[model samples]
Target: MSNDFYTSSILPYAAIIIKICRAYTNTQEDFEDYYQEVCLQIWRSNENFRGQSEWSTWIYRLTLNVCLTLLKKNSKHHVTSNHLPDVVAEDNRTFDDESLNHLYNAIKQLSEVDRAVILLYLEEKTYQEIAEIIGTNPNNIGVRVKRIKERLKKILDGKVN
Candidate 1:
């Protein structure tokens, strides 16, 4: 992707990209990789935008799909090796609120679809918009969102693993 196109198409939506990438990744290295991959995929798929949906909506869908795909692939290739050095962040930054950190950790426990749903909900997307992005019935989004909230509460309360 050229610097000009990336600056025009992606930099404007960097926040959305960062939030989605953060939700899907555990470590800084993984986060950087996912962020790069998402940008690349968005650039590659730019030509496919048919204008049926708003640009933000298209970017959201593409971001979620790419994250989910990479997550599934990583899970299948689960590799553990003590010989590998541990990754450490060069910048030492921490969340100010423990509860917020816990909340995010809880959110990470959700199923991929539920995670996407909750993220969209947190972003204040309409149920219809979420359903359109997630390929679900609009009416079902409310029920799912309610259930997802309950699940998250349980996760935060140590009632669910």
Candidate 2:
């Protein structure tokens, strides 16, 4: 990727990529790998974009697809572990907000498709936008978002086993 293009095209949209990668990954190392792969994939696949949608929307779909694909591949080769290790912060630092941590931990428990839906929802994407991205009906997106929200609330409240 050219430095200028990356700075202009990818850097501006990196937050969406990072958040999706973070939601799908349990550890920092895995997060870095997924993030790298997403960036590389976006660069490799940019030419295929036909400009039918906004750039941000295209990036969102690309990021989600890459993360989900890598996740599925990893699950097949690795034994599933119930416990996620504590994420060690760089320079021995920690995030300032506890609720954010709780939220992300809860988000991590959602099914892959639900995770993508909720992430897009949290990003304030419209139901139609989410539907377009996920290839579902707009009406279904509302119902799914409602259900996912309720499930997340239960998880946060310690009601869901």
**Could you say which candidate leads in lDDT?**
2
Per-prediction TM-score to the true structure, in the order listed: 0.87, 0.91
Alpha carbon deviation, residue 86, candidate 2 (Å) = 7.5
Candidate 1 residue 151 Cα shift, in angstroms, is: 0.8
Residue lDDT tens for model 1, 37-133? 9999999999999999988899999999999999888878876321222232112122567666566666777778988999899999999999998
- Each model's Cα RMSD: 4.5, 2.7
Worst 10 residues of 2 by lDDT: 86-95
Cα lDDT tens digits, model 2, 1-161, are 88987898899999889889988887778889999998899899999999999888999999999999999899999876433434532221213677777787778788989999999999999999999888889999999999999999998898976
**Alpha-carbon shift of residue 119 in model 2 (angstroms):** 0.7
Q: How does residue 20 of candidate 1 score in lDDT? A: 80
